[model samples]
Target: MWQPLKEKIKIHWPLLALAGVSALSVGMVVALLETVGVLNLAPADSAIVESELAPEAPSAVLGLADRPPAQRTEALSLIAQQQDNQEGHRARYLLATDLLSQGRGGSALTVLDGLEQDYEALAPYVLLKRAQAQTAAGQPEAAQQTWQTLAEQYAQHPAAAEALYTLGQSDESTWEQLIANFPAHPRSVEVAAKQLPVATGAKQMALLRLLVNYGLHQSEYGTWLDQFVSEYGSLLTPEDWQAAGFGYWETQRYGKAGSAYAKAPASPLSRYRAGRGAQLDGQRKAAIAAYRQLAQAFPDAPETATGLLKLADLLPQPEAIKVLDQVMARFPNQAATALGKRADRLDALQSPTSAQQARDAVLSQYSQSEAAAELRFRQAQQQAKAGHYESALSWAQQLLKDNSTHQLAPEVGFLAGKWALQLEQPEVAQRAFERVIGQHPESYFAWRSAVYLGWDVGDFDGVRSLDPQIVLPDQRTPPPAGSDTLKELYLLGQDQDAWTQWQNEFRDRESPSVAEQFTDGLMRIGVGDTLDGIFMVSNLAWREQPQARQEYLALQADPAYWQAMYPFPYEQLIETWSRQRQLNPLLVTALIRQESRFVADIESVAGALGLMQVMPGTADWIEAQIGQTGYDLTQPADNVELGTWYLDYTHREYDNNALFAVASYNAGPGNVADWIQRGGFTDADDFVRQIPFAETQGYVEAVFGGYWNYLRLYNPAIAAKVERLAATQPNS
Candidate 1:
């Protein structure tokens, strides 16, 4: 019986291979290796027959191979299948969520429209989202109606409350009513208070009082002051009026404060402050007269010093200097320290020549003060601007050497490098660039240096590059084997019959591969057939373009290729990068797929190489700056790490404009930025067509299209919407 079964297995080798080996076989092999005390198999597992096995265990090599689309699509499909999408409801809801994330509120409403009852519990949510979408899509009346309905039907829901608040914000009276009705709601309170004051707690009341007294009011300024004086008259004492005047003076509303202070004659402080306000208001003679009177009325008062300074500064320059000298003589040792400081300030306020003299005096007298240090830096900048490179360099060097840990150390270093470059010192410029890269890899300057040297450009990360010349076949046939293992064996030994079987079986699973094989393989994986999925994928290109997959076979045979494939669990790597960079995992995976297609040594039409498809210029620039030129860009880990960083940089540069930045990465910033300056685009679709470069235009469409599909397929929430949208929207 066993012999008959064996014979039967021999006849149907594909089925037997499926039964004897699988993802589980890879896991078992790994476990067996571990059990034998292999400390780190990464270094010594070349002969391992992990992914080449059959499908008896369906849990092996889920993330192997250099290809990304097949794997990412499979991952998304498997994940979606594991989740429960009840009819079109879940899919619709997911579609709405995805639409919302992608800033497509109107589209989201269309998705939610068909699931009115199915999404009833989420109806208020959908309505609120619809309201926002309506507003964004320029349907204000519709938005208002949607919000009103939400308020009427689901007032208790948070979304309903938010919708109501939004409606109130659209109209002041309605907002006031909302606040009056829902005083406990913070948004209502905030909205009402913005127009009409509402002092809730003690702190709030205090802030309101301060705002009324001192806030920059828009013609409503005097209204608040008048209200405060009327309602809180007892609190508005002479001193309060004086403080209000000071507030007015601080806000440059000297006229209003003076009017308030002039009304309060009992407080000398108010009168003095009012006079100062008058001075600040450009009524210098009036200020001087007021100060003189105050000084006469209160000779020994503390206000005398302020009054004297006002009087002295108001005098002609020569006269003022004479008065300052007299003040020093008469008030000797009484306010001597204050007098000297005042004299120095007055001197600094003099003409530029005099100001320079004063700055030198201050530096000599008080070398440790912040003002002196600022003066020094300012003088240095002036010298640099004046083309006194030697003096500028000397000052910068002195600052760096003296203030070793100064906040301006980097600035000085940059300036020094610039100066050195101006002096024709390439070695110095190179060192400066290296210093920035070494000491501040995260700095904008370092990033600029990398770009200048053509290294690690964020825009070039993970570019989809194919060296159409070398690895690309000259037109070959499909794998001949019908089984994955036999196919592997035949490829290993160049057996034509087995290779043919491989090709036929691969095509049997999916005849046309426009990203559908990815979904099919993932479906197989979801149903507990992991090895089948990988086999379908790794050998997919070979189904029709056997030569392509055959080339991969030869490449895969290299231990280094397996090393790249085995060490990284693709899902885990994607997950880690996505989370750290605040990006979608499937998006990152899709980028990697388009870029290297997991081929660590792939090169592009633009001369980009390695897993992330970095340009040679960028690689060289990065090498020089990092001081680590020994790295092989063909290694997966190095490629991934650098690619991730570059992606992060591009994401940051474009204000998280993934579509624009990704396009820029492929086409070039000159093209993208130029297109952006052209304007008039309403949405991503419009923007896509408006792209002038045909290659970049297609690249953008393909990447984002791929990204959208992956996002929907992998993330259950996104997948649901994608499926629903695919059914409903012609574009999807």
Candidate 2:
């Protein structure tokens, strides 16, 4: 009876169910509303990394001993103190010297007066400056007394002659004796010469040459010559005297019509025009001899090469070839065009089969010539074409070693790497590839090196030891993820497309946060890359938002923030730490990316461990100082802390200059410092370009590049604003 009733109700429910369902839904909603409230949620752990507060462990400490902050600070402070006094004195002297150099002699006098009595040598120099200042200020009596003292005390030095010259009015009788004693001096001769009548055109022209021999670039000699020529126009041959005078004064031989009006025949200009005419007229031998004489006599003269080239053009094939050989041997860059012309002429005269024979003859006779080097390179290329892999590799290697800084070094390094790989020598090949990257990071060879190193070695199956499975992070091989979310978010910032691409690719398969980190690290240390993706993204992002722009400006103001963001590899940090006290943040970032992909515990084939890949010696040293004897080197935070601290020390040691400090960190302080002194590094970039160590050079560049990328992507606004500011400058 119940079953029949339920069936009837279910069948009739459509009509009744609509009303019942509405009431039940209302009741359920009311019940659920009382139990729940609105929920606002953020990430479980949302905190931005502060560059300043971040721990920077000495990179070496990852494997060795670590120093506690108190002890490390104490040690570094003592070291700094040890050199402070000397550094201070040097700084003061430089300041004073700068003031003097800028023509603020009175200010320099005040600084010199403040010097301590202990600065004996410097005191004398300051006194000299004071005397010069007095003279400049028109206090002749005061200046005279100062000069009298300088002449008495510093007689052996050149100061005495200078002082005596300045105070010659003190006594006429004394001045006469002084002139007699210093008769060989120019001032004495000048004094004697002033008593005579002024020189005429011929006499003036002759006098100008005498001044030229003594090394002066003044045009006074030229002025006198012109006056003489104008006054005695009818007495002398205008062209002869004018040409002679031009010859003497036109040392640079940049012959404008009026430049050589006041010199004698012995001048560089006279020799240049005469030699040029002779060579053009086909007096080959005479021209060659004349050019040799001119060039040998006046090595710094601009006409030197002009004469030589003219001479070479006029000579017969045999003599011309000899002259060309000499030119190539001595001045390769200057003679490149001539050498190529000669090579082309020879090639035109010979068939393909005989070209080699002709080149060989040239090489055999002129082994040291630029012509020979080019010929040899061509021969090597031929060998490569013919599949003589070993021969080609050998030749390329010789060229690379012999002319390491040559213009063709990149090409040679690339070829060596390629051929070495073909010959089944991975180590040699890697070295060759490294050479290209190290010496010419901006070249096509560097790009190729990155590609070859980053390619999936596994894809090229038959190539042994390449292991395409092992991919390096820096290479832009396979494209990065094409995630639309990342694209939109990145572009919402500054939208520097090129930099975005680089950042996306550089981050590659790494975690997004880590990738962002890598980008931010590079921008602070001036690690500029035209194609760096991280830099582009950050630049754009900063451009898009005011808040992000502020963060970037803050980062730029704090160098340490940039320092912590560095991705130093184990080997490089260790090397840098050994020499300097601080690490360049860009370099650190690049190394970290390359060595560990930001993984702290990663080990290498050589038994190196932790973030910096420290060996046992490194670990022990770090352990001893920090008293964290049992600390694990594999821990990420620990390794980063230890590495950054050591880097800080390097910076402290070198007074925060990344160049000297970084080089010392890579090569050792003593070594880098010696190189600095030896290399005479007046310009920073020039010094970087001239780094002799291939590994060290590449290490510096990549690390700095990585750091720059980090800052550019994350803190875009500062760099963006910098661009604006640069544009506003008058010179910009």
Candidate 3:
């Protein structure tokens, strides 16, 4: 039987202090190891792999992208076994690709013979491949004919652009035709780069913008921007300056970004970014002037609060304290953080009495403020850490009552529930968990609440038995902005058309609306650039723009909004692997979302690869254990197959304890075992709260949070339950 913590226990602050010191030491060690390249933490793997593998050969065969080049032989062999169905058709196309890669152009053409009708989506690619093969086999006339056929038949396709570029090797007119007809295709970048020196005025500006929007190489773009600015700085419009600022900012040229933004727009956000850029560039006086100007010009803007905060950081203590006080008085919700800083400064100045007074003032004057709630929440954490569960519960409850609408409300409510469980107050804990679901269903903590309530979604044991039904929304509203044609393209799954259209029309990149950002992310995802797409969508949660935040908050009220946000791409692959491993498909999907954001070829700094981020060493070990070989971690199917097997293995190690399994997956069984031994944590919440590694702790929350989001967004029963709880809330 599971035992809750006893209601009464001796409490001491010194014990909590000791725990904090120990956790900090552990964190430092982990950080040091990571800094020196010893710790192979999972989340950092993607960035590492991307930088290391970027210059390698492209990892796709007939659009089966991200597979390792070393696996071409294995892939070809696998495709040979299935030559009768749709898989067989795909296999043949890939087989041709493999042959072409190996300079066996005649063999590749032989394999591609008469398959044009069968591979409709890949027809242009097949022809292009065949043409290259012909050229490789020294049949120049045959290659020319094949390229001409592709150019004539697939003029609108990207393959046509490639074909034109190839034909342009001997004829400049063909390149000019490519530039005229397919200006949005990537090959146009190459054409424009070659022609940019002779281009003038409007044409030059247009080409520059295209280069920036398409994310050209940094060295090349920087040279282009510098040359363009030097020649045309005085002739450019505010919009041109804005575009230049965005391009510079994206490339981390903060000094240039600031200079450009200073001349671009007078919007609060623009001014803030200008100041931020200047600050980062070490232009202290200019940054201060920009901040002051923004504060005076747009006092009511959300940027003004941030400006004031930054200004305080640069000012003398007395001036800083005054600015901090102003921030707390004007932006109470945002003020708690500023006030906390003020309290810390007072203490640091050896004014303990003053610090106490300042803290008391926040509690009394801003009792209903977020700062007060934060103070109370901190106190609760301290009490809990000190083993004073009853006191912690009281403070947490007070925070809930006073600051229910504050951003920290969900976290406080969840913590209160955890403390209640520690105090053996099951009923109180249940209500607290219910309140979290009712009031803040979109939060990661809401998922934690669901786990405690024994929902089958990512539950320790229930996941093994419960079969969840996935219910997708029947109708999705098109994004509010964008042309009707572009919207239609997106709705119709004409991803390339929609992407090109979006790039051409998406003008305010610096200050896009929440909807526009979301749409932009969707467009990027649609075009198979998962990294940037996921970055854009996931970044919305941190936006400080008042209007954008309000729009996001309003959108969160709708279930469809979340469904779009946490989309389930690669459903067939996820389902096949989940079923094979006897796991919930949604759980597998959630894990993939966290691991790689569904980016098939993303590698982490720790060298974890593909959708589930399995490390190379782990893959080798799993292969040995499962008696499987020739699996490519970069390929989606292979990665998921091996990843899910590892997931299942972890579950079995802990007797289906999802919490332990997830932690073990991230930090490894060795580290998890050490933490378990050190903390002697039996309860899930207790173990999570006391987990020494902040990285592992966050990973657990994120994985389970993603699991709950999938459930409420996709499972009808869970969605209805969430809706019902939300409807019963006082705010609702």
TM-score of each: 0.30, 0.34, 0.70
- RMSD from true fold, candidate 2: 31.3
Which 10 successive residues of model 3 have the least lDDT summed? 12-21
Q: Across residues 1-732, which tens digit of lDDT does each residue of candidate 3 receive?
A: 212223332221112211111133434434332322222222222343223211112211222322333433343333233223333344566666656667777767776776677656466767887899899889999999999999999887666788898999889889878877776566777888887888888888767766655544334988778766777888877877787888888779998898888888688877887888898999988988988888888887878888888888777788888889888878755676687679877887789998888788778777787678888988999998899999998998888888887778888898888889888999999999999999999778898788889765555556654568987643334655686646644543446656766765676676788888888877888777766777777787887666777887786665646766688788888898889888888777878888898889888998999999999999999999989799999999999999999999988888877788889989999888788778766577778878889999889878878887888888888889899999888872
lDDT at 553, model 1: 45
For residue 355, give model 2's deviation from the true position in Å: 5.2
State the local distance difference test value for candidate 1.
0.50
lDDT against true structure, model 2: 0.47
After superposition, the stretches of candidate 2 with alpha carbons farther than 4 Å from their true spots are 1-124, 132-140, 151-156, 160-251, 254-312, 316-355, 361-369, 379-395, 401-407, 418-429, 436-732
Cα lDDT, all candidates:
0.50, 0.47, 0.74
The total of clashing pairs for model 2 equals 88
lDDT string for model 1 (1-732, tens) is 001111111110112211211233434434432322221221112333122222222211211212232222222222122222221233344444445555666655665564545444345556766777777667889988988998888755444557667876666566644544444343543453474555544434444454553243234655655566656656566655654555565456786666566656544566576568778788887777777776666665545555566677677766666555555555432234334444455665665665555556545654444344455566678887788877877776655444433335545556666676677876866565555444433233443343334442322232222111111111111132333433232222223222222222343221334233543333333333333444445554343244554554454333323222222226666666666666655556657766765556667787888766887677676667557766677776667666666666666666777777778777766777888888987655457757878887777655654453343223454334324422442210
